[model samples]
Target chain A: MQGYIVKRILIAAFTVFTVLTVVFFVFRLGPADPVMVMLPPNATPQDAENLTKKFGLDKPLMVQYGNYLKNAFRGDFGSSFRFDEPALRVLLMRFPATLKLGLVTFILSVTVGLSIGLISAVKPDSIIDRIGRLFALAGMSLPSFWVGIMLILFFGVTLRWLPIAGRGTPLHYIMPAFCMSLYPIALITRLSRSSMLDALKSDYVVMARIKGVPEFYVILVHAFKNASIPVITVIFGIFGALMVGSAVVVEYIFSWPGIGRLVMESFFARDYPVVQVFVIVVTCMVVTLNLIVDIIYAYIDPRIRYQ
Target chain B: MHSNQDNLLELQDVTTTFFTKQGEVRAVDGVSFSVGKGEVVGLVGESGCGKSVTSLSIMRLVPQPAGKIVSGRILFKNEDLMEKTAEEMRQLRGDRISMILQDPMVAMNQLLTVGKQLGEPYKFHDKVRGSLREMCIRLLEKVKVPAPESRVDDYPFQFSGGMSQRALIAMGIANNPDLLIADEPTTALDVTIAAQVLKLMKEIQRETDASIILITHDLATVAQICTRVIVMYAGRIVETAPIKIFYKNPAHPYSVGLIRSVPVLGQPVDRLFSISGQPPSLFAMPKGCRFAPRCNKAEKKCFKHYPPETWLDENHSVACWLYPGD
Candidate 1:
C-alpha cells in the first residue's frame, strides 16, 4: 500500500512539474511584451526595465522558470498583472466556487446516470431502455456550450424558470450544473448499463437467483456492486475533465468568479503570471483527483487492497 | 425400476431448445430420467451431450435469449415444474433443489466473501438475517472448511480450487435442500481434491438425505460415486441402469465403448481403447440411434430409423435395437 501511494504521489509531482515547465515556456515563447503590459503606457523605458527586473522577467527563460518553481515551493505565486494581487490569493478566492459547482455536478451526474443505466439494463427491451439510450446519445453528441445555451434559452429565457447565468444562490447553480453533467451522465450511463448487463448474466448472478434472492435484490446488491468498478472509475475521471471544461464556459456564462474565468481573462490580456499559475493549479487539481480516484478504486475492490 | 414410493424427482419428455440466428436447436431432445430419494443419479455424457442442459432444465435455471425448457414436465414431488411461475420455481430452487455447477472457481461469485455467499441462501430462504453468522460457521464446518469462523470472510480467490468447491457445496446445501444437482463439480480440481470433494458430497448427501444429480463426462467418476447412471449421447439418453447392472451387463454400445476407453491402472494392453468418432451435431443429428454412426453393431434398421428405448430388465433400459435381439 505504501509503495502504491508513493508511486502515485511521485507521478503526480512529476506531472505538476512537467505542466509548470511547459506552461512557463509556452507563455514566454509568445512575442507579447510582458514589460509593456505591466507598465503604464506613459512610463519611460527605464521604468519598464525596472518593473521587468522587479518581476524577474529580465532574466533568461530557464532562470525565470527556476525562480517560479522556487517561489511555488514556498507558496509564492507572483502577483497577477491585471488584478494587482498574488496569483495564489486569486486562486484560493475562486477555488471554492468551482469546487462547489464541480461537486454538485459530479454527484448529480453519477447518481442519475447510474440509476438510469441500471434501469435500462434491467428492463432492456422496454421503453425506459430506449429513453436511456436516447439520453445517452444526446449527452454525447451535443457540445456543452450549445447544451448550456439551449438549456438557458429553454429554462431561463422561455420558461423563466431558472437564472440564465451567475453563481450566488442555489437557483444560479442549477443550469450550469446541468450543462456540465451532460457528458459524464451519458458516459456513466452507457458504461454502467453495459457492465450491469454483463454482470446480470454472469454465472454468479444466476447462482444468486437460484438461491432465491429477490429479483430486485439480485440486481441491486449482487449485480450492481459487481458492476460498479468500471462506472465509478469513469465517473471519477470525468470529474477532472468536467472541472477543467466547465470552468471556462460555465464561468463565462454564469459570470461566476472562478479560476476558469480567471484563465479566460488572463488569455485576453496575455497575463503570463496569471495564466501560468492557473495552469499549474488546474494541473495539481487534476493530478490530485486522479490520485483520489485510484485510491477509491482500491477501496471499493478489496482484491486490490495490498498488505 | 424404483417404485413411485422412492422417486423424488422425475422428468417426462423434457426438451430444451436454444434459438439462435440460424434456427432452433434442440439441446436436450426428449430426455427423461428420475432420481430416487437419497439416490445419486449420474448424467454421464461428453460435452454438448446435454448433461448440463438436463440439469439446468431440472432446476429451471437456463438463461434466456438462447435457451429455454421448450417441452417437458419436470415433476418434483408430483408437482409439475412447468406449470409453476418463475417466482414459484425460484422459491423451490435453492431451498428444495440446489445446484453446484462445473468450474467451481467461476461458479461462486468472486466479489462476495465465502461466508456471505454461504449465508446468502439462508437469508434468502429463511427471511431472517438473524443467526447468519452462526449459520455461516456451521456451513463452513459442514463443507469441511478449516478454521470455519476465520476463513469464511475471505474472497473466493483466497481459497484453493478444492476449497472453493467446498464453499460452493456448502452454499448449495446451506438450506438443506432435498435435491443437490452437482454439475461436474470436480472438473476444475486436481485428482486428489476431486476425490475429496466427491467423497465429501457423498458423505453430506448420506447425512442430509438429499438426492444428487451428478453431471459428469467421466465414466470413472460415475462408476465411483453414482448409484444409478444415465448415459447420454447426442442429447438423448442412450442407456440408464443401476450401478451394478450397468458395469456387469452394459447394454448400450456407447456406454460399453466409454467404459472400455477409460485407462485402467493395472491392465496391460497394446494400446488403450478409444471411442473412434466425434459426437454428432444436434442440428444435423443422424436419422437412427445417435450412436449408430459410431456403433460397431450398426445394422440397416439402425441407420434408417431412430430406435425405441428397449427394456433389458426391470432395472435397466437401452435405446438400441441390438438390446432387443436385432
Candidate 2:
C-alpha cells in the first residue's frame, strides 16, 4: 500500500509537470502577448524592446521554458503581469474562497443527492421517486449559468429574501453554490440510485434482511456502503473539478472572488504567470483527488487491493 | 407430518406470489409442511421450483412490493408468522429464526469483516452480552474455520468458497436460532467441500438442537443429512416422506425420476437418467398438476385436475393419481 501511494504521487507529479509544460507553450504560442498588453499603444519600438528585455521575454523560447520550469520547481511562479504581485501568492489568496465554496457545494450536493437517491432506491416507482427522478433530469440538463440566473431572479429580484451575488455572509453563498451544485447533485442522485438499487438486490443485502436487521439499518449500514462506492468516484471527480476553478461561469455571474474568476480575469489580461500557475494548481488538485479516491476505494471494498 | 406440539415450524397452505410486468405468478402455491424440533427437513427441487422462495417466505424476507405471501399461515412455535407485524418479524428473525443463503461468495457483505458479520445477529438480537469478537471467534471455531481468532477479522473475499460457507454457517447459528433455513448452502462448493459443509450443518443442528430446513436440488445432499425430504415440482409439493422411505420406496413419479437421476458410483451407463422437459413457466401454468406435462405416468385425469396429497403411510405422503385412495 505504501508503494502504491508513492507510485501515485510520482505519477501525479509527472502529470502536473506535463500540464505545466503544455500550458506554458500554449500561452507563448497564442496571439496575446503579455509585453504588448503591458505597453502603452503609442510606445516606441525601443520602449517595447526595453520592456521585453526587462521581463526576460526577448530570450529564446527554450531558455524561457527552462527558467520557468526551474522557478516553478522552487514555488516561485513570477509576479502576475496584471496584479504586479507574486502569481502564486495571488492564487493562494483566492484559494480559501474557492475551497470553501467547493466544500459547501460538495456537502450540500452529497447530502441532498444521496438522500433522494437512497429514498428513490428504497421505494422505487413511488411518488417521491418519480419526483426525485424528474428533479434529476432537470438538474442534469439545465445549464448552470441559466440556473444561476434563474435562482438570482427568483430569490434575489423577485423574492428579495437573499443577496444576489458575491461571497460574504453564508447567505451570499446560497444562490451561487446551489447553482453550481445542480449538475453534480443530479449526477450523484442518478448514479447512486442505480448503484443502490443493485446493492439492495445483492445476496448480502438479502442475507442482512434475513438476519432480521431493522429495515433502516439494512439499507443504511448494509447496503449504503456498497452502493456509495461508485457515487464516491463521481463525487470526488466533481469536487476536484470544483476545486480547480471549473465553477467559472457561476463565479463570474455571482461576482464571486474565487480562483475560477481569478483565472478568467488573468487569462484576458494576458497574465501568463497567473494562468500558468492556475493550470499547475488545477492539475495538482485533480491528480491528488484521484489518488484519494483510489485510496478510499481500498477502504470501501476489501476486494480492491493496491499492490 | 409431526404433531403440532413437537413441530418447531409449520407452513399451512402458504402461497407466495410475485407481481411482475408479465402478470401475477405464484412462485410457491399452497405449500404445507412441518419441521419438528431437532429435525432436519430437506426441501428438494430443480431450479425455479420455489424451494428458495419457500425458505424466504418462512423468514418473511420475500422481496417486497413485487413479491409477497398472498395467502396462508406460517406458524412458528404455534405463532402465526404471517400475522406478525413487520417489527415483530424483525425481532423474531436472527433471534429465533435465521437463514443461510445460497452462493456463500456473494452472501456476505464484502466491506465488513467476517467477525462483524458474524456479530450482527448478536448485535441485532441483543442475545449475547459479552465481547462480540470472542463469540464470533467461537462460532467460527464451531464451524471448523481454521485460525478463528485471526481469520474473523478478514473480509469475505479473503476466504475461499468453502471457508466463506463455513463463516456463513457460523453467522446463521450465532444466535442458536430455533429454526435455521439453509437455502442450497453447498450448491456453490466442490463435492468434497459440499459434503463437509453438510456435515458441519448437521453437527451444528445436533449441538444446538435447532430444526433445519435444508433446501437443495441435490438429493445426495438430502440423503447425507436430512431426516425427512419434501420434493417440490413447479411450486407444488410432489412428495414428502421420511428420508429412508424416500430413498427406498419413493411414491411420486417425479421423486422416482429425481432418485434415478442421481448416478450411482461405479455403475457406468451410456447416459445418466434425467427427467426431460423444462419446468412450466410461471406466466402460463398448467391448470391441472403443475408437473403433469413432464410426468411420464401422467394420465388424462392428471392433466385435467391437480392431485391432492395422498397418504402412503403414517409418516409419508405422495401427490400422484397412481396412488388413488387406500
Candidate 3:
C-alpha cells in the first residue's frame, strides 16, 4: 500500500510537469505579447527593448522556459504584469476564498445529492422521486452561467435579498456557489439514485432484510454503503475538478475574488506569467485532490486496500 | 404428509407474484408445505421452479411494489405470518427465523467485515451484557474458518467462496433461530465445497435443533442431508415424500426422471435420462397440469384438467392423475 501511494504521487508530479510544460509553450505561441500589453501604445522601440530585457523576453524560448521551470520549483512565479506583484503571492492571497467556496459547495452538493438519491431509491415511484428526477434533469443539462443568471434574477434583482457580486460577506457566495454546484449536485443525485437502486436489489441487501435489520439500518447501513461506492468516485472527481477553481462565468457574474476570475483577468491582460502561475497552482490542486481521492478509494474497497 | 402432527412451519396456498412491465408473473403459485421441528426438509426443483421465491416469501423479504405475496398463510409456531404487521415480522425474522442466500460473493456486503455482519442480528436480537466478539470468533471456529481471531476483521473478499459460505452458515444459526432457510447455499460453490457446506449445515442443525428449509436443485444433495423432500415443478409442489421412499420408489414421473438422471456407479447407459421440455412460462401457463407438457406419463386427462395432491400412503404424496385418491 505504501508503495502504491508513492507510485501515485510520482505519477501525479509527472502529470503536473507535463501540464506546466504545455501551458508555458502555449502561452509563448499565442498572438499577444506580455511586453506589448505592459508598455504604452506610443512607447519607443528602446522602451520596448528595455521592458523586454527586464522581463527576459529577449532571451531564447528555451532559456526562459528553463528559468520558468526552475523558479516554479521554488514557488517563485514571476511578477504578474497585470497586478505588478509576484504571481505566486497574488494567487495565494485569492486561494483561501476559492477553497472556502469550493469546500462549502462540495459539502452541500454531496449531502443534498445523496439524501435525494437515498430517498428516491427507497420509494422509486413516490413524489420525492419524481421531484428529484426533475431536479437531476435540469441540473445536468442546464448551463452554470444560465443558472447563475437565473439565480441572480430571482435572488438578486427580484428580491434584492442578497448581494450580486463581491466576496466579503457570507451572503455574497450564495448565488455563484449555487450556480457552480448545480451540475455536480444533479450528477451525484442521479448516480447515487441509480447505484442505490441497484444495491438495494442485491442479495446482500435482501439478506440484511431477512436478518430482520430495521428498515432504516437496512437502507442506510447495509444498502447505502454499497451504493455509495460509485457515488463516491463521481463525487470526489467533481470535488477535485472544482478544488482547482470555480466556474469562470459564475465567479465573473458574482465578482467573486477567486483563482477562476484571476485567471480570466490575466488572460484578458495578456499576462503570460500570471496565467502560467494560475494554471500551475490550479493543476497542483487537482493533482493533490486526486491523490486524496485515490487514497479514499483504497479505504472504501478492500480489493484496492491490499494493492 | 404431517397434516395432524405439530410442525415448526406451515405454508398453505402461499402464492406470490411479481408485477413487471410486461405483466404479472405467478412466481410461487399456491405453494404448500410444512417443516417439522428439528426437520431438515429439502425444497428441491429446477431453476425458475420458484424455490428461491418461496424462501423469500417465507422471510417476508420479497421485493416490494413489484413482488407481492398476493395470498398466503405462512404459519410459524402457531402464528399466521401473513396477518403479522411489518414490525412484527421484523422481530420474528433474525430472531425466530433467519435465511442464508445463494451467492456467497454477493450474499454479503463487500464493505463490511465478517464479524460486523455476523454481530448485526445478534446485536438486535440477543441482549448480551458485553461484546459479541467472543461469540463471533467461536462461531467462525465452529464453521472451521481459519484464523478466526484475525479473519473476523477481514472483509468478504478476503475469504474464499466456501469460507464465505461458512460465515453465512454461522450467521444463519447465530440467534439459535427456530427455522433457518438456506436458498441454493451451495449452488455457487465447487462440488467439494458444496459438500462441505452441506455438512456444516447438518452440524449446525444438530447443534441448534433449528429446522431448516434447504432449497436446492441438486436431488442427490437432498437425499444425503434432508429427511423429507418437497419437489416443485413450474411453481407447484408435485410431490412430497420421505427421502428413502423418494429414492427407492419415486411416485411422480418428474421425480422418477430426476432420480434416473443421477449417474449410478455401475449402471451402463447410452445417455443420461432427462425429462425433456422446459418449465412453463409464468405468463402463459399450461391449460391444466403445469408439468403435463414435459411428463412422458401425462395422459389426455392431465392436459384437460388440474390434479390435486394425492397421498399414496401416510408418508408419501403425488400430484398426478395416476394417484387420484388420498
What are the lDDT figures for the candidates, one per model? 0.85, 0.88, 0.86
Candidate 2 local lDDT, A107-164, one digit each (tens):
9999999989999999999887999999999998998888888888999999999898
Scoring only the second chain, what is candidate 2's TM-score? 0.97
Question: lDDT tens string, model 3, A1-307?
Answer: 8877888899999999999899889888888777777889899999999989987889999999999889878988888877789988988888787778887788889988988988999999899999999999998899887778888888899999989888888888788778878888898899999999998998898888877788899988988877877787778765777544445667777888887788788778777777788878778877887788788877777778886
> What lDDT score is found at residue A228 in candidate 1?
89
Task: Give the DockQ of candidate 2.
Answer: 0.75
Candidate 2: tens digits of C-alpha lDDT, residues B146-225 = 99999989988889999999998888888889999999999899999998998888888888999999999988888899
What lDDT is reached at residue A117 by model 3?
87
Docking class of 2: medium
Chain A TM-score for candidate 1 is 0.91
Question: How close to the true structure is residue A124 of candidate 3, measured as C-alpha lDDT?
Answer: 98
Question: Which of candidates 1 and 3 is the stronger one according to DockQ?
Answer: 3
Task: Please give the C-alpha DockQ score of model 1.
Answer: 0.56
DockQ of each: 0.56, 0.75, 0.75
lDDT of 1 by residue, A1-307 (tens): 7677778789989988888778777877888788887777899989988888888877888898889889888878788878889878877888888888888888899899988999889888678889889999999999888888888889999999998877778999898888888888899989999999999888888888778777888888889888988887787665786668766887787677777887888879877777778778877877888888777776666677553
| Candidate that would win on lDDT | 2
Comparing 1 with 2 on lDDT, the higher-scoring candidate is: 2
* Candidate 2 segments whose C-alpha is farther than 4 A from its true place: A29-61, A242-246, A305-307
Candidate 1 chain B superposition, TM-score: 0.96
